[model samples]
Target: MGELDSTLGAVLIAGLLAAVLHGLTILQTFLYTQTSGSDGPLMRCLVLFLWSVDTLHTALISHTLYFYLVTNFGHIGVLAAPTWSIIVAIYLTSLTGIIVRIFLAYRLFLLCGRYRPRLRVALPAIVMIPTMITFLTGLIFASKAFIVRLFARLDTFSVYLYITFSAAALADTLIAVSLCVLLYRSRTGIEQTDSLLTTLIVMTINTGLLTSIFALLCLITYSIWPLKFIYVGMYFSLNKLYVNSLLGSLNARKILQAKQERSTHDHRRSVRSTRFEVVSEPASYLSPAESITMSGVAQKESFASTSNTLHQNHVPDQT
Candidate 1:
C-alpha cells in the first residue's frame, strides 16, 4: 500500500492538477484567439498547434492514470510497468517545451539583431543548442522507458532523464538572462520607454524562472527520492506552464500598450506643446502586436544612435 500510495497516488494527484492547468491553458487560448485577430497567420497557427498538442498531452496522461488506478485496480503487479500513454505524454511535453523555447529565442534574436549582427545570430544558437539537447534526450528517455517498461528499472537509465531536465533548465535560464540583459540595455533616458523596458524585463524573468524552477524541482525530487513519482508529477504540470507562459506573453502586449499610451499622454501633457516624431530605422522590433517601436534618433539622452521609442499610435485595443 505504501508503494502504491507513493507511485499511483502521486500520479493521480498530479494528473488532477494537470487537468486544472490544462483548463487554464484552454481559457488562455480562447482569449488569445478573441484578442489576437490582427496577429499574423504564422502566430495564429503556432498558437493552434500548441493548444492541440497540449490537449492531446492531457488526454494521454489521463488515460495513463486511468489505466493504472481503475483498469488494473486489483493487480498490484501492474504498477511495476509504465503504460504506453505515459511515455508518449512525456515526449509531447518535451515537444511543447521546445516549441515555446524556439519562439522565445526568435524574439530574443529580434531584440539583439539591431545592435549587433553577430550577436543576433549567436545568442539564439546558444539557447537552441541546449534546447535541442533537451529534446533529443527527451526522445531517448521516452524510447528507453518504453523499452525497459518497468518502474523499478528506471534508475538504470535515470541519467537520460537527468540530462533532459538539466538541459531544459539551462536553455530556459539562458533565454531569460539574455532577454533581460538586452531589455535592460535598451533603456532610453525617457522615463516612459525605460519603464516599459523594465516591465518587459520583469515579465521575461517571471515566465522564464517559472518553467526553470519546475524543471529543477523535477530533477531534485527525482534525485532525492528515485522510487517516488513526485518528479513525474512535476513533469505533468511543466508542460502546461510552457503553454501558459507563451500565451501570457502574447496577451500582455495589450496591457503594455495601454500603459504605454497612458504614459505617453502624461508625458505629452507635461511638455504642453512639444512634438514627438518617429524617425526611420532598420531593424524594427515590432512584434505581431506592435506594442513598442524603436528607431534611430539624435536625442541627447537616448541610449544609442538607435533609441527605444513608443508611438502614440499602435494596434487598436483588441478587447
Candidate 2:
C-alpha cells in the first residue's frame, strides 16, 4: 500500500539479512561472558549493545523493506501499525551503533600518537553523552507521534525524522574523519602483534565511512534502493571480524609466549653447559692432589662463538 512494488526476491534477501543479524547477536551474546579485563568489559558492552540493537534494527528494516517493496502481503501499507515507529527505531539504533563504533575507533586512535588529542575530545561526548541525548530526544518526539495516533498525520512527522536523522549523519561523519586520520597514521609501524588491532581500526573507519554514506543517501531520498535496511547486516559481519581477528591475535600471542619460554630454558641450559666444570681430586686426601680443568667446555665455547657468530650480531639497531 506504500508507493513501492512487492517483489518476492527482495523479501527473501531481507529475510536472509535479518537471519544473519540475529545469529550474530546470539553468538556475540554468548561469547561476551568469556571476555574479561579492564577494557574488555567496556568493549564487550559496546559490542553487545551494537549487536543487540542491530538485530532489532535489521529485522525491522528488512520487514519494512519487504512489506513496502518485496512482499504484497495482505497486511502491507504505510498504515501498518509499526511503520513509522520502526523507522524511528532504526534511525536511533543506527546512530547508537555509530557512536559505539566511534568509541572503538578512538580506542585505537589513542594508540596512534597523532590522533590521541582528537580522540580525547570527541570520543567521550559521542559515546557517553550525546548518544543518550539523541536517543532520548527521538523517543520523546516519536512517542508523541506514534503511528496509530498520527497515521493520518504522517506528513507532519517527516520534518522531525529529517532533523534526527541529519543529526545522526553529522555525528557519524565527524567520527569517520577521526578514524580516517588514525588509520592513515597506523599503516607503517603496525607490528604483527597489533595486526588484529589494526584490522579493527581499519574496519571501524571503513564501516563508519560507509554508514555515513548510507545515512546521507537516506537523507537524499525515500526510495527502496537507498533504504537503511542493510546497516544491521553490515554491523554484524564487521563485529564478527573484529572479534575473530582479536581472538586470533590473542592465540598467536600465547603461542609466541610459549615459544619464548622454551627458548629461554634452552638458552640457560646452553649457558650452563658452556661454562661447566667437573672438579676431581686423585685417590688419597693428603698423598696426592690433582685438578682436572674444564678446557673441554672452554674449547667448545670458543668453537661455538667462532661458528655461530651469535654474540657479534646480538646488539640492536639504535636507529
Candidate 3:
C-alpha cells in the first residue's frame, strides 16, 4: 500500500478505536441506569438519545472508511471524492456536537440558578450560537464538496471547518470554567462537601479539556496538512469523546453520591459518639468545686418544692 493508503488506514483505525470507546460508554450508560435507578425520565431519554446519535455517527464513519478502502481499493482519488456517506457523517458529527453542547449549556444554566441575572444566562448561550452557526456552515460547505471535485476549490471549506472547531473549543473552555467556578463557589466550609465538589471540578475540567484539545488538534492538523487524512481521524473520534464525556459525567454521580453518603454516615457516627460520651460521664469525675455546686443546686430545688407544697396546704385551711 502507498503512504496515502497507509494514512487513510490510520484514520480507519482511529474510527475503530472510537467505536470501541463508544461501546464501552454504552455499557456504562446501561450500568448507570440499572445501578442508579433514580434518574428521571428526562435523564434516561437524554442518555438514550445521545447513545443513538453516537451509534449513528460510528456507523456512518465506518461506512465512509469501508467505501474508501474496501470498495474503491487503492483508489486514492476517492479520498477527495465527496460521497453521500461522507456528507452524512459530517452532518452527524456536527449534530452530535451541537446536542452535547446544548446539554452542557443547560447544565451551566441550572448551576447558575434561575435567580442569576439575565446576562449570566445569556453569556454561555451567546457563545454557543457561533458554535452552532459554524457547525451548520461547515455542514453546508461539506455538501458543496460533491460539486467541487477539485480539492483546491474547497479552500473556503477549510475556513468554515476551522471556525467550527475554534468555536467549539471556545465553548468547551467556557463550559469548563463556568462549571469550575460555580462548583468552587458552592463549596461549603465542610470538608466532605468541599471534597465532593473538588472531585466534580476535576472531572469537569478533564472532560472539557479532552474535547477542546481534540477540536484544536483537528483545526490545526486540517489547516496545516490539508492534503493528508490525519485530521480526519481526530474528527472521527471527536464525537465519541463528547458522548463519553457526557455519559461519564452522568455515571460519575453515583460514585459521588455513595461517597457523600459515606461521609454523612461517618459524621453522624462521630456526633453520636460525642453525645454519648457527654451523657455517660460520671459525676464522680467532676472537680470538687463542680460537685459542691451541683449539691447546692439540688438542695435549693428540694427546698423550693417543700415550700410550694406547704403554701398549698395553708391556702386550703384558710379557705
Candidate 4:
C-alpha cells in the first residue's frame, strides 16, 4: 500500500498538477497567437509546434495514468512494468526543453551587441554544447527505458538520468547567466531603458532558476529513491515549466514595449504641461485687464518667433 502510494499515487498527483499547467499552457498559446500579430511567421510556427508537442505529451501521460490506475486496477505486479507512453513522454519532455533552450540561446546571441568581442558572441553558442548533451542523454535514457521496460531495473539506468538532468541544469544556468551579463552590458545609461533591462535580468534569473531547480530535484529524488515514481512526477511538471517560461518571455515583450511607449508619451505631456504653467504663472498675479494685455503680447511674441524660424529655415544661405 505504501509502495503504491509512493509510486502510483505520486504519479497521479504529479499528473494532476501537470494537467493544470497544461491548461495554463493552452491559454497562453491562444493569447500569444491572438496578441502577437507583429511576430514573424517563424516565431508563430515555433509557438504552434510547441503547443502541439505539449498537447501530445499531455495525451501520453493521460494514457499512462489510465493504464495503471484504470485498466490494471488492483494489479500490483503491473506496477513493475513500464508503459510505452511513460517512456516516450520523457523523450518529449527532453525535446521541449531543448527547443526552448535553443530559442533562448538565439535571443541571447542577438542581445550581445554587434560591436562586442567575439567571445561574447560565442558564449551563447557554447552553451548549446550542454543543451545538446542533455537532449542526447535524454534520448538514450528513453531508448534504454524502452528496452528495459521494467520499474525494478530502472536504477541500472541511473547514470544516464543523472547525466541528462545535470546537463539540463548546467545548460539552463549558463543561458540565464549569459543573458543577464549581456543585458547588463547593453544598458543605455537611460533610466527607463536601464530599468527595463533590470526587469529582464530579474526575469531571466527567475525562469532559469525555476527550470534548473526542477531538474536538480528530479535528479535528487531519483538518486535517493530510484524505484519510486516521485522523480517521474517531477519530470512531468518540469517540461511544462519549460514551455510556459518560453511563452511567458515572449508575451512579456509586448507589455514591456507598451510600458516604454506610455512612459515616453507621459513624459512629453508633462513637459508640455510644465511649459504652459510657466507661461501662465505670472498672469495669475495680474488684474483681469492686465492679464488680457499680457496674453495678447505673449501670442504676438510666439507668432513672431515662429515666423522668424520659418523665414530662417526657408532663406538660402549666402556664402
Candidate 5:
C-alpha cells in the first residue's frame, strides 16, 4: 500500500511536469508558424489538431489523478476501478501516436523519391500497420479495464498493452533510422547544405529517441511490476512527447531556411568582393586601347554578375 501510494504520487508529479512542457511547446509552435509563414494550410491544420488532442489528454489524466487523490482520498479501491477519463486518455494517446507515425512516414516517402524503388518508405509504412493494430487493441482492452478489480488481475490486458508499447517503440526506431539514412544519402558535397542536413538528422534522432525510450520504459515497468501504476506514469506522458516532437520538427524548417539563406548571401558577397578586387587593380601598365578594352570587358562582366545574382535570389531553394 505504501509503495502504491508513492507510485501514484510520482505519476501525478510526472503528469504535471509533462503538461507544463506541452503548454510551452504549443506556444513555441504558434510563434514559429506565425513568424516563418512556411507551413501551408494543411500543415497548420495538423498542428492545431495535435495541440487540441494534447490538451484534452492532459486534462483527462489530470482529472483521473485528482479524482483518486483528492475526491476519493483514503479509498484505494477507487484506483483499481478504471475511470472513463483514463480510458479516453488512452485512446487519445494512441491516436496521437498513430498520427505522428503517419506524418513521419509521409516525410520519409517524400524524402525518398519514386524514381527508384526502395524499401526506405515501404518498410516503415508496413511496420506502422501492426503498430496501429496493437495500439487499437490496447485501447479496446483499456476500455474494458473496469471489469478487473485490481491492477494485478489484468493479465490479459497487460499482454495487449505490452504489445502496443513494443510496437510503438519499433515503429519509432524504424522511422528514425530510415530518415537518417535518406538524409545522409541526400547530403550534397556543399558544406552549407551538408551542415543543414546534419542538424536535421540530429533533430530526427532526438525526437524519435525520446518517444521510443519512454515507450520501452512503460513496457518494461508494466511487465516487471504490473501491480504498480508506474507504467501509467509513462503512458500518460506519451502524447505530450509525440505532440512536442511533431511541432518541433515542423518549427525546425525556419532554422534550416535561415541558414540556407545566410549561406547563399555569404557566397554572393564573396563573389562580388573578388570581382571588385579585380576591377580596382591598376591598368596603367597597358596601352590606352588595351585599357579601354579591359574596362569594357569588366563592365560586361559586372552586369552579368548582377543579373545572375538577382536570378539566384529570386529562384526558390530546392532544399
Candidate 6:
C-alpha cells in the first residue's frame, strides 16, 4: 500500500485534469450558442453524459486501484472489507460507460448503414452481438482473481489487462470496418447532406480507429507509459461529440434552405415561360339582330340626295 502511494496521487491528478477539460469544453459549447444563436440541446446532452461518465470512470478506477493495490496489498495490520457504497460506484461507472458506448455505436450504425428494411435492422444486430461480448470480456478482465482462475497460463493481472485491451480493440475494429462499408456504399443512392453526413462518417471512423489503437497500445508496455494520464479515456468521446451533433443539425437546416430556394426559382421560371392571352372580338361584321337595327340608316341617306335632284329639275320647268 505504501509503495504505490504516489501512483494513487498520479491517478487522482489525471482524473481531476480530465474533469476540468470536460467542464471547459461544455462551457465553450454554451458560449458558442450564446454568440451564434444556434443552440443544440441534444448534442449538449450527449456530451454532458459522456464527460460525466468519464469522470465517474476515473473515480471508480482510482478507488478500485487503491483498494486492490494499497488496502489489500498483503498489509499486516489492516484488512480489506466490502463496502456497499464503493461497490455501487464501481458498478455504476463501469456498467454505465459500456452501456452509453454501445448506444453511441448503435446510433452511428443507424446513421450510416444501408437502407433496406431487413438489412437496415440486421446489420446493427450483427454488430451488437460482438460489441456486447467484448464489453462482457472487459468486465471479466477487471476481476483479476476470477479471470486467473479460469485461465492458468495468464498468471499475472497484467496479462489479463492485455486481454481486456485486445477485446476492446476487436470491438473497435468491427465498428470501423462496418462503417467504412457504409460510407463506401452511400455514393450510390440519395444525395447526402454534406457537412453533417461527412462529420458522422469521419468521426465514426476516427473514433473506431483511435480507440482500437489505444487498446492495442495497452498490450504493448514497450509503449509510452500506458496512457495512464487520461483517467479512463473511454468516455472522452463526450467532449469531442459536443459540436458534432450541432454541426449535423445546422447541416440539415442549410440543405432545407437550399431546396426552398431552388423550388422558388423553378416556380418563377415556369410562370415566365407560360403564354396566356385574352380573346379579341371582331368589329368589321354585324350579327343578324344588329343588321335589323341598322336598316333605316342607308334608306334615309338615299332619300336626301333624290329630293335635292328633283328640286333642281322643277326650277328648270317653271322658267
- By lDDT, the best candidate is 1
Task: Give the per-residue lDDT digits (tens) of candidate 4, residues 90-150.
Answer: 8899899989998887776665546665864688779999999999999998999899889
lDDT of each: 0.81, 0.46, 0.72, 0.81, 0.74, 0.45
Write model 2 residue lDDT over 1-319, tens digit each, in one string: 2222322344446456556645655664555444333234555565556555656655565665566554545544433343553545545454554455444444434544443576655564554343454455456556756644533454455565455446546655665565555445544331332343355455556555555565555555433333333322332233233333233322333334454456446655655554443333433443222322344456455445432432221111110
The residue-by-residue lDDT of candidate 5 on 146-197, one tens digit each, is: 5664665678667678788888888888888888887788665556666777
Give the per-residue Cα lDDT of candidate 1 at 277.
28
Tens-place lDDT per residue, model 1, 1-319, is 8887788889999999999999999999998887796788888889999999999999988898889888998897887788899899888998999999998888877777565999989999999999999999999999999999998899999998999999989998998899888888777667777787788888889989889999999999999988788888999999999999999888888788789778756654543322222322222455422321322222333432212364311212222
Which stretches in model 3 have alpha-carbon errors above 4 Å?
Answer: 118-120, 280-319
Ranking by lDDT: 1, 4, 5, 3, 2, 6
Kindly report which residue pairs in candidate 6 clash with one another.
none
Q: Mind giving the per-residue lDDT tens digits that candidate 6 earns over 1-319?
A: 4423323444445445545654554565455444433435654465456545545644555564566457666652222232232334434434543554565456545644354667667767776665566556555544543433322223344443455556556766776776666655543322222323354466557656766675565455313443232323333332233233333333334444455456446544543332111112223486544544444344334344433422221101100
For each candidate, give its TM-score against the true structure: 0.84, 0.51, 0.82, 0.85, 0.83, 0.48
Per-residue accuracy of model 3 over 31-119 as CA lDDT, tens digit each = 76775576567777878888888888888877877787799986877776555765676777787778888877777766666567784
Q: Report the backbone clash tally of model 6.
A: 0
Candidate 5: where is the Cα deviation over 4 Å? 146-149, 277-319
After superposition, the stretches of candidate 4 with alpha carbons farther than 4 Å from their true spots are 277-319
Q: Backbone clashes per model, in order?
A: 0, 0, 0, 0, 0, 0
lDDT of 1 at 266: 69
RMSD of 6: 26.1
Worst ten in a row by lDDT for model 5: 310-319
Off by over 4 Å in 6: 1-13, 24-52, 58-93, 112-118, 144-160, 188-196, 222-319
